[model samples]
Target: MLSFLEGHTSEVCACAWSPAGSILASGSGDSMARIWTIADVMSRSSLQNEHSSVVVLKHVKGKTNEKNKDVTTLDWNKFCSAPPASYPSGMGCASCGHVKFKAGSARHGVFRVEGRLLATGSYDGQARIWSTNGKLKSILNKHKGPIFSLKWSKKGDYILTGSVYKTAIVWDVKAEEWKQQFEFHSGPILDVDWRNNVSFATSSSDNMIYVCKFGESHPIKTFSGHQKVVLLFLFSFSSGKKGDMWVSAKHYFVWAKLTVSNGTPTGSLLASCSDDITAKIWSMKQDKYVHDLREHAKEIYTIRWSPTGPGTNNPNKQLLLASASFDTTVKLWDVDQGRLICSLNGHRGPVYSVAFGPNGEYLVSGSLDKSMHIWSLKECKIVKTYPGSGGIFEVCWNKEGNKIAASFADNTVCVLDFRM
Candidate 1:
């Protein structure tokens, strides 16, 4: 089954599934974040009568029809489960408590895992926390330039914001204040991700990645090798065992595992990809790269580690890495062997995003060609194809792996039901 969500007046840049997979939130250039209720879609017997409800959470103030207040990025609170329909007021906002940020666009917004608080970073050089129901909780008024990226710790105790000012700040969630600020990057900070509750990593346009921990005055580990700006990175610690870490950075994608012995972090594994047409895997223990994957003909846009393999959700499946690129292809790499598994060649335009299903049996890729493809890992072929009306920016699968959501440049979001 397929459904098109049309409400945003401009491009829909970001969309995230609720932790429970009952709701989907999409951010748009229209300066609005919309919560869509899709619980009934799965039970409906007929596609002809399909209907879902949406709650528009306006990010702008005053004018009902405002412009330039683009909601650039948004993430759902990982710990929250109740949808907007369960809220008493159906997503109403408090007029007085909300802070009216400057007209600059909001670059990133994320929800803490424990509390229902949502943290949003803007070009106005400020970050604001909002309740899931649209009430402003607190305002983080620091940073000297636009915030390019922000992330909430898995424990939900701290929030990290990276800015073009070449600094990254860790904010105390409960205290609603800045705990520590790190001025380590020589260029604008592009992305930030938490490695653990207290330690995290940051990437910068200066072609470097820094790993820092709480209460530390400087970065504990500095990774330098990417020839171009590092766009983004993620730290995945799915395996409860020590010495298992996965990290990725744009232009460079790094998968690293922090080896812990008696509670002390010993070493890590890092993987990075770049516009230089190469992807390299580094070993923190050896302090050098162990594998260099050079197969793509164009600049790689994004890469993701599969949620399967050892220490992951599906331990029976081999660990794989998927990378999308401007060459209009998606390549899967064996993490253990550091070799190409297969190349998915279908899209006509540059592929922008790729995501693995929670079970790791399938992979999905979205491309600027205005299409999305769902491929079976075992068969290594496209099992399903979805044509879109606009260029696709992002694609993601819900936790249940039953629904896939894609954001497009045409100011719309599409959801594909994949129960079969």
Candidate 2:
């Protein structure tokens, strides 16, 4: 590790590398988010470091003794420019202006794809929008229960929030109002992801997934099969152009460009894992799953698709799916063949997170064993391992893939210089 960040007073639950990969953002149980500047340290020749700049973002109002003030999640916007002049009124707030947060902790934070605005959901049944520089922009106050997950559309025009009230709301970013509200989930919504700008999919504690569009009162499509609570969902595309893709709940969803003989687009595929110890791939054209991955002995915690294959940054590499499990192993899958390519068995504890480098040549996995391993995809072996002071909650590779930022249970964040 190049340096350790120690300002947070509690466990750091989440961390995200900025799109440019120069800045690192972390959310902690201390009711605060921190922006750490590490570009200078990364440029130095020496591996060891201590001094670095940090910006502390307080999420609570004036001093209080309330509990559960943690910042549960964090995300960085891809764009950094100011919003256009035609944006809705009352959407711009000063960077230093203080916005009061009620009696609950912030559960999730996501940035608009355009990169200028951030939206955060809290347990107080509200979602707040903020500028990139940490200004309060607007407050969304419609959900009656605590929010659990949220996401911004790819077009940067809308924000989707899922709440414990069993409802999901689509907020119009430009208009600063909710565009539509869907209340079809029978249980608390755990996670959500946008398949396109107009439609999205939601996973709930009811073991069901629903795909909803902007104006539709009912789900366009529903997926059910998991016998346990669905925790997270993601959409992966097959090509560079916008095309049909799949959505999965709890584990992950893989989307690929489906085309017909005439070159027109068809629907996409979806892959999902669950507490049931299996990850299944689904087809949009049919009701049955395409593949059922059942090698894990315990619950699968997370899944990530490699940024490779056709149309990605690493076009020459094969596209693969990675699943991290409580079974203390990370498995790489050949999504097209519906088979396991290799099993990463270096970590001694349950793997909590796995991330592929931007170049898609290496993969990083962090575990409860307090160790992070960097594996060479081609060799299917660990090339480097870094032991941490605490169990790691999350790990992410910067855009350049030369730096990695990890959040830990020890109330600290570590930035590892990968080039070393």
lDDT of each: 0.70, 0.72
Best by lDDT: 2
Give the per-residue Cα lDDT of candidate 1 at 338.
76
CA shift of 400, model 2, Å: 1.5
Q: Score candidate 2 by lDDT.
A: 0.72
Model 1, 149-183: lDDT tens digits are 77776555678888889999999867889999999
In candidate 2, what are the lDDT values of residues 282-393, reduced to their tens digit? 6555555667788899998888888876656666777688899999999998867779999999988999999999888899999999999999998999999989889999
Worst 10 residues of 2 by lDDT: 93-102
